[model samples]
Structure formats: structure tokens, C-alpha cells
Target: MEQKTVTYEVQQNVATISLNRPAVKNAINSDMHRELYSAFVQANEDSDVRVIVLTGSGDAFSSGADLKSVATEKLGDIDYGDYLKETYNKLLLYMDTIQKPTVAYINGIAVGAGLSLALACDFRIAEYDAKMGISFLKIGLVPDAGASYYLPRLVGVGKALEMSLGEPISAEEAYRIGLVHKIGQPEEFVQQLLTLPTTAYGLMKNVMASSYEHTLAEVLQMEEEAQTTAGKTKEHTMAVQRFLTK
Candidate 1:
């Protein structure tokens, strides 16, 4: 297959999706957008892929939508709003719904839809020096790619509004505000981030996703339900019996 804008590789059970356009800061052009959507769908279908990590090829995660592409394209030929609503929106929606966990390794700048992509992930692990922004306001545009939805929920409505309306924020500040789950020094970030797959982070991901929409009472019920369902699995039973005997 001719993979251009995005690349996918599997290690253990984790599927890593890299945005390959480093020359342009991994900006999301139409090709990259379509490629990412396809890749997510592929990962969802593959039973071998128990977890997914979304990252970029170079230092920057993504610069958001390709403004250069947007500037030259004619709105008359394509109904962009409809196109995005149907396709791009579905990408975030699917990411949220995927049974397996997903993580965003924000190694560098993540802006606009790029930030939304990070937000949509079950967890965001960032390099301490990285920058995150909902920079749509800078270009006189509204947030898309689930920014309008996820931002408010992640950082609360007031904080989300301020961040979207304000300039970009540093990754450290983002961590303090709950936007990012962990911040690691740039040199050690990749190695540090690998621990997430080995930890209880995947279960935490599922818990957080469920907490986002469910009430506290409902959430407790869900936890119990998950416990019961997981308890029946051979993997869970083996681990439980091993611990008991030990």
C-alpha cells in the first residue's frame, strides 16, 4: 500500500500512528485527514491492536488544518462543513468510542484540530517544552475536530474558553490544568511514555472515558458492571488466581 501522509507500525499490542509530514510540521491536509481516518478505522478493526499511540514524525505533533490548502481551495466545489461533519468528525467520534485504549504522545506543538486530536485521546502524554493551542481564533475560525466538544469537558467550560480564546499554552501549564495527564522532559519522554502500556493506564483510560458522560451513580454502576464482565475473562481469572495463590 502507498502510505504517504501517515505511517502505522505495531509493537507488542500497541499500534503507533505517526503523522509523516514533518516538512510542514505535520499539518493536516486533506490527504492526511483522510489517511488518519482510515488508519483509525483499521486499528479499530485489528484484534491485535490492543492500544494505539498517536504521534508525529518530527518535533511537532500537528499544526492543525493545512491553512495553505484552505487558502487556495474553493469552497464552492466542496461543501467543507458537510465533509468535515461527516468524515473528520467521525474520526474523533470513533476515537472516543473505540473499545481499545488510545493515547496521544504530544512530543511537540499541537494546535487547533491538532490539539483536538490530542484531547480526543484517552490520555495525553506531553513533552514538558511542548505547546498546545486552540488557535482557531487567531485565524478568525471556529474550533473543529471535536475541539468544541472535548475542550470544555477536559478543562472545564471557563478554562476551555480562555485557552481557545487566548494564545497557546505551554505543556507544563496544560498538565496543571488537567488537559495533559503527564509531562516528561523531552530527552526522556519517549522512554517514560512507554510505561503507560505496562501500567494500569489502559483501564484508567476506559474509566475516564466512561466518567466523561455518566453520572456519579451511573459511573459506579458501570464500574461494577465492568468488573463483573472483566472477571469472567480468562486473562482476568488467571491474574486473580495467580495473585491469590502467591
Candidate 2:
């Protein structure tokens, strides 16, 4: 499918899918959402693709929802929850569980749902100058698009609540509080994603996400299961052989 809001390309087994509406900081609308999902599907299905990197076109990663579009909408008894069910909910779930490791390359400002999208990623690599915000309460809305779920787990409930209720934070503060795993150039991170034993990464990613809800015995069983699966991969066999030789 032709894409206008997102740009997709594959090189060195990496599928880099970028949000392309730099004019407005890549603010998402329905078209962008649909195109973003399609790009993700393409990357996930391609045999040559092992890593997915999501970034923005220009300086800003994303500015969240297109408020102008919302402003233009015929406001009435419009069901916001239903709107999420149709758009962000599905995208977030798919992204959250996309088997392969996904990185949100935060280039600049990310607020509201844009921040939520980053939270959906397995890892977040941010530029030093990037700024992040929840910005929901500022508009009298609460967090959506998986922010509520990922934030508390990411930075703990105290920091999450503070950030959500207060001002936007700098990239340094984000990293200090565990909002981002790394704050540096994203190129090295992308290269590592492309070259790493990502099959094992995918397996571990799923198990890790599921471990949160599973009991210790159940988690042990899952570890056994995931280990068995990972042990069978060609990458694992090669890695073990490489280790033995060294």
C-alpha cells in the first residue's frame, strides 16, 4: 500500500518506519494511524526484516493527536473510548506484542498519545535534546493509548503520576527517572538492533511482558518453554559455538 503519512524502507534487515508529518510534528490523524499500522504489518511479515525502528521525519518525533482535526470535528456526544477502541487501542496492542524487538527512536518532542506510542515500544532511545510530556491533565483528559499501563511500570507509580500531572520533562530527566533506557545517538542503537540475536530477543520480549501477570511457578514454566524455543534457533546455536571457540 502507498503511504503518505509514514515512510517505510528496509536495509540491512532493519525496517525503519518513520512518522512523516514534520510540518505539524507528525501529529497523528486517522490516515497516519492506518498507514502506520500497515507499515508495521509489512515489517513484521517480511522475512528479511528482523528489527523495527520507529522515528519521526524531522526534529520532533510526534506531537500527539491532531488537535486541529479534533477541533474541526462535529463535537457532540462523541464517545472518546470508542474512538480509542477503533484507533490507538488496536495499534498499541499490535505494537506492544509484535514479536520482534521494536524501538521508538524519540527524535524530539513527544506528548500525549505520541508519548504513549513510545511506551509501547520494547526500548526507547532518545536524543539528548528530546522532550517528553504526558500533557493529558493539561487538557482535562486522562492518559490513553497504553500510557497508563506502561508508565507506572516504567518509572514507577510515583514518578509517572508526577510527570502525568505536571510539566513536560527533559530527556535527561526522562533517563534519570527511567522513562528512557538510553539517551544518546540512535544510530548505534539501531545498528545493535539490526545485528543482535533478535530471535532470542523476540522470545524474551514476549515472555517478559507476560511474566508481569504470571505467578512464579507459571513464570518458571514459561522460562522453560521460552528457553526451549530459544535454544532451537540457529542464532543461539551459532552464538554458543562462537562462545565455545573463544
Candidate 3:
């Protein structure tokens, strides 16, 4: 089956969903939004897929929305809120709801909604020289696609605001600010991330995502529940047996 705009592949328990529009720096259009959501859903539903990685085909991860597709006449008539509601909002929500761990392997420049896409992932690992930022203000738009929500959570409110208003930062700087988990050569980066235990990682992602909106008591309860579910997994059982033998 031909996958348009995005490519989905599974190898060694990792499902990689790549944005395929290299000519425009993998800019997301309506079609890409649909394809990406489908890719995530596929990975989430596949029991063999342990992790999902999102990246772009070319030098840039993504440059955000395709401006060429936007018509001047339609700009005035466009319902911006409705546009997001139908497209990116749905994709972001679906991504957030996936129980599996998600990683944004930011290979290069990521700006505007592209940054938001990376922020939504449970972890971000970038090429050492990659540039990343929320650049919606440069085009007279506010950050959409969950940037406003995830940015502050990742980098703190003050730093998130500053970065949103400023130019893109290098991957090294992004790591220093905790925007990215790591920066390294592509091969090493992916290898390191894939070493994580998938079932445990997913549960931890759930705990962290919930912690932001939940009270301490509620978060502890959530952790206990998630741990109970995770403890019953085959992986967990095998790991314990291995530890006992060792």
C-alpha cells in the first residue's frame, strides 16, 4: 500500500513515521495531517511496535505549515479556529492519547507548528546542529498545534515565552534548556532511545503527562494503577526472571 505525504515503517519493534515533503522542508498540509494521524494510530494499535518515532525526510524536520497552499482571498474568509479544530488539533489530540512512547527525532530545522509537533512527543532527540523554535509570531499568528500548552510544560513558562518570541535555538541550547532530551549523531541517538524498555516507558509517559494536571495524591494513585498494569506485561515478567537468574 502506498502511503502518501508520510511514510510508515516498522523495524525491530520501532515504528518510524516520516514526513515525506522534502522540497518544502516537510511542511505540513491538510493531507499530511491526515496521513500522520493515521500513521500514529497504526503504530499505537500494533502490538509488536514498541516505540514510535516522528521525523522528516530531508534536512529539516518540518518548517511548519505550507504557506503556498494558503490563498490571499481565502485568508479573509478562513475560520482559523475551525481550520485547527478540523486538522492539527485532532492530530495532536490523537498523538497525546497514544499509550506508546513517542519520540521526535528532529534531524534539522523545526519551527512554528513543527516545533509544536516535536513538543507533543514524549521525548525529543535532535541532531546536534538542528535549529528549533516556535516562529508563529514571525507570520503574525499565535503558536497553534499545542505549542502554547506543551512548550511551557517542557521549558517553563518564562523560557517558553522567550523562545516563542525569539529566533530558533541550536540543538545544544535546546538540550541545555531541556527542550530536547539529547543531541547526538543520528545513529547513536536512535540507538540510545531504542534501548529503553517500551512498556515501562509508556507507563512513565502517562504518569508525567498526568502529573501536570493532577494533584500529588491523584498522581500517586495514577502511578500505582499504571504500575499494576505494567507489572503484568510479559516483558516485565521476563525481565524479573532474568534479574533473578543474574
Best by lDDT: 2
Candidate 3 residue pairs in backbone clash: none
Model 3, span 128-188: residue lDDT tens: 8799988888878898999999998888999988987859999989999999988865455
Pairs that collide, model 1: none
Which is superior by TM-score, 1 or 2?
2
Question: Global lDDT for candidate 2?
Answer: 0.89
| lDDT (0 to 1) per candidate | 0.80, 0.89, 0.87
The RMSD of every model to the true structure, in order and in angstroms, is: 3.3, 1.3, 1.7
Per-residue lDDT for 22-43 in model 2, tens only? 9999999989999999999999
For all predicted structures, in order, the TM-scores are 0.85, 0.96, 0.93
**Residue 50: error of model 1 in Å?**
2.1
The CA root-mean-square deviation of candidate 1, after full C-alpha superposition on the true structure, stands at 3.3
TM-score of model 1 vs. true structure: 0.85
> In model 2, which runs have C-alpha deviations exceeding 4 angstroms?
71-73
Query: How many steric clashes between backbone atoms does each model show?
Result: 0, 0, 0
